[model samples]
Target chain A: MTARTPDSARDIPEATVARLPVYLRALTSFAEEGTTTCSSEELAVSAGVNSAKLRKDLSYLGSYGTRGVGYDVEYLRYQIAREIGVTHDWPVVIVGIGNLGHALANYSGFRSRGFRVVALLDADPTRKDEVVAGLDVRSFEDIESIVAEHAVSIGVIATPAIAAQAVADRMVANGITSILNFAPTVLSVPDGVGVRKVDLSIELQILAYHEQRKSIAPASEDAS
Target chain B: MTARTPDSARDIPEATVARLPVYLRALTSFAEEGTTTCSSEELAVSAGVNSAKLRKDLSYLGSYGTRGVGYDVEYLRYQIAREIGVTHDWPVVIVGIGNLGHALANYSGFRSRGFRVVALLDADPTRKDEVVAGLDVRSFEDIESIVAEHAVSIGVIATPAIAAQAVADRMVANGITSILNFAPTVLSVPDGVGVRKVDLSIELQILAYHEQRKSIAPASEDAS
Candidate 1:
C-alpha cells in the first residue's frame, strides 16, 4: 500500500464517507451546546462510533485534529461543512405531492442546511389545488420550467413506484444532476447522474436480519 | 484473509448488506417480466453496481450461481429474501400520521416485503379521528395496546421534531426494538434498540457537498 497523503479525501473509503455525515451532525449538536473542542473518544461516544475509526476517518479529509489535544469543534465543523458542500445552498425540487411530499415540503431541515426546496410538484391536476407545507402542489407538467427557473441541480422523487421512472427521466432530462429517490424501485439515470435511494422496507428488513441473528445466537456474545 | 467459504452469507460486509435489497428489487423486476437466471453483468447494470463488486457481494452470499450458467432466478431470490429476514412477515407500526407517516402507511413496498404497518399513532389528540392510508390515525396512547395486539417489534417515527423523541421513548418502553426515524432531530435511544435515520436534507447536503466540490475544483483528482 502507498503512503496516504495529508490532503487526500479520495483515499477515504465509502464506509467512511457515509459516516462523515453522522460525525457532522454530532459536531453540529456539540457546537450548539457551546463546545469548542472535542477528543476522538468524546466525539465517537456521542456519534456512536469507535475512537480510532473516527480519527482515521477524519484523517482522510486532512489532519484537522491536533496530536494529543483534540479537534477544534468550530474549525473542524467548518472544514467538514466545506468538504461536504453545505458551504452554499443547493436548491432542490421535490417531485410528488403525495403524503411523503407533503412531509418533505414541511421539513425545515432542508432550508436549515444548504438545501432549499424550491418546488413541490405532482402529476394529478387535482392536486394543484391543494396547499401543502405552505406551498401549492403544482402539476408535474411544470417541472421543467420550475427546475430551469430555480437552476435546480438536485431533485427529490417521493412519488409512487409507477411514476418514479417517468419522474427520474424528466429530472435527468431537465439537467438535474443528483437525485434522492424515496421510491422503492430501482431508478435508471444516465451515467453522470447520482442517485441515492431511501427505502423503508429495506431498512426494516436489515433490522430484521440482525434481529434474527440475535434470536438465533443465545450465547458467546453480549446478546443484547 | 483466508479463502472465503462458498454458500455462506456471514462474511458479507455492511456495504454489501445495504445493496442486497437493491439487487433483490432488480431481480424482482426481472422475475415479474418472466426472465430466468441473469449473468453478473446484467444484474450489476440493473442494480446500479459494478459487475466485480456485485459478484463479490453475491459470492459472500453463496455460490447460488453456476460457474458458467449464471444465477438461478427463483433460487437466488428466495436465498436473498431469506437472508434479508423478509421471507417471513414482520409486523410494524408507523407513529405520526403526518404526511410522511401517511405515505409510509400507504406505501405497498412494506406490504410486499414482509412488513405490515399495524397502526398509525399521533400524539395530538386531534389527529386521532383522522384517517390515513385506509387506517384510522389513532392517538399516540394506542402504541402499547397496538404493539401488544399486533405483536409489533419495529416502529417508524415520522413525527415532527418535538414529538419524535417522545414517540421513540414510548415505542421503546412498549417493547419496540427497532426504529426508522424520519425526523431531522437526533434521537437518543437506549441500547438494544436499533435506530436508523433517513434525513432528506442530510442526503441532499451530502450531494450538495459533492456538487459544490465540482464547482470549486480548479483541477484535482479527488473523486470522494
Candidate 2:
C-alpha cells in the first residue's frame, strides 16, 4: 500500500473539497461550545449532510473515528483546515468596491477563517480614495501592483456582469489563480485558474423551487 | 408505469434541481442570441457541464431532444422554467440594507429570473427613509406588514453574521418560509422553512483548497 502523505490529500474529490469548509465550520462551532468529540451522525446534522456521506467525506481526509468514541473535534478541525490550506492565511484582493465588494471587505468570517483581505480595488474613478473596511479603495489598475505586493493568489469579482470578464481577465493576467465571483455571469478562465461563483439569485431560485413544490404537495410532507 | 403528472416533477434529484436553473440560464442566453435550436453538446458547453450529464439532466424534465434536429431552445427553456416554478414570479423581501443588501437590491438578475424584491428593510433608524434600487428603505418592524402586503413567501438575509439568526427568526415568524441567506453564519430555522445560503468566504475557501492542490502537484498534470 502506498504510504499516505500530504500529497495524497490533493486527490480528494471536488465535491468533498467544497464540503470540507462546511465540515470545518461545524467543527469550529463545536470547538467553541467546548465539545471535544462528535460522532459522524452529530457532525452530519450540524453540517446539514447525511451521516454516511459525512463518514465517507471524512475518510477522504483519512479521518476515521473510533467505533465508540467518534471523531475528535479539535483534531478533525485541524486536519480539515490543514488539508484545505487554511492553516496559513491566504491573502486576497477584492475588485469592484460596489455594495457586494463593500460587504465582502467588511465580512469578519474571512479574517476568522484564514483569509486576509489585502486590498480593495474599483474601476470607477469616483470610488478611488474611498475607504472600506479600513482600507482605501484603490484604482483597479493597481491590482497588478497590489497582487504582486501581497502575493495574492485569490481575487474576488463583485463588479457588474458587463465588467466581470474584464476584471477576471485582469486578475488572471496578474497571477490570481482562484476567483470568487459575485457577478451574475460565467467567467471563462485559463486552465490553471479556478472560478467559484456565489450567486445570490440562484440560491433564491433554488429555494423558490422547493417553495413551489411545498405549495403543490401536502403540508404534512416535508420536502426537505 | 404510473402516469406522469406535474407533481411528479417534484421528484427530480436535488443535483438535477440545481442544474435546471443553469440549463435555463444557458437557454435564455441562446434565446437572446436568436438561436432557436441547440444540440446537447452546445447546451452542455454553455451550461459548463458534460454533454452526457446535460442530456441526463434534461431527461429528468422529460425533455428528449429531437433525434437529429436537436432541442428547441424556447420550448426547453419554458419547460425547465415551469418545472422550477420560475414562470410564476416570487415576491421577496430583503432584510438588512447593508452593503451586501444594497448589492442584492440592485441585482437585476433577480427580476429577470423570477424574484421581485418588494421591500428593503433595515433595523437601523438612520437607514430608514433612504432610497435604494428605487424603493425606500423601511424599518425592520414593517416586515410583518410588508410581507403580508406583498404575499411574499421568500426572504433574503444579507445582514451581518451577528444579526443573521435573529433576522431569520423574524422572517420565519412573519410568515416567510423560504430564505436566501448571504450572511456568514449558520441559521437555525424550524422545520418546514427552507434556507439556502450563499457564503462568499466559504466559496473562497473551496477555491483555496484546489489552489493549494495545484501548487503541490506539477503544472504538467492538471489537478482538475
What local lDDT score does residue A183 receive in model 2, on the 0 to 100 scale? 82
On residues A45-145, what C-alpha lDDT tens digit does candidate 1 reach at each position?
Answer: 87778899998888789878898799999999888887787777788889987777887898777787777778899998888888877777888889889
What is the fnat of model 2 with respect to the true interface contacts? 0.74
TM-score of chain A of each: 0.91, 0.91
> By TM-score, who's the top model here?
2
Candidate 2, position A179, lDDT: 94
RMSD of 1: 3.9
- Candidate 1 regions off by >4 Å? A1-13, A61-72, A222-224, B1-11, B161-166, B185-191, B219-224
Worst window of 10 by summed lDDT in candidate 2 chain A: A1-10
User: Of the true interface contacts, what fraction does each candidate have?
Assistant: 0.57, 0.74
lDDT of 2 at B84: 87
Question: Candidate 2 — which residues are off by over 4 angstroms?
Answer: A1-10, A34-42, A50-52, A63-72, A218-224, B1-10, B218-224
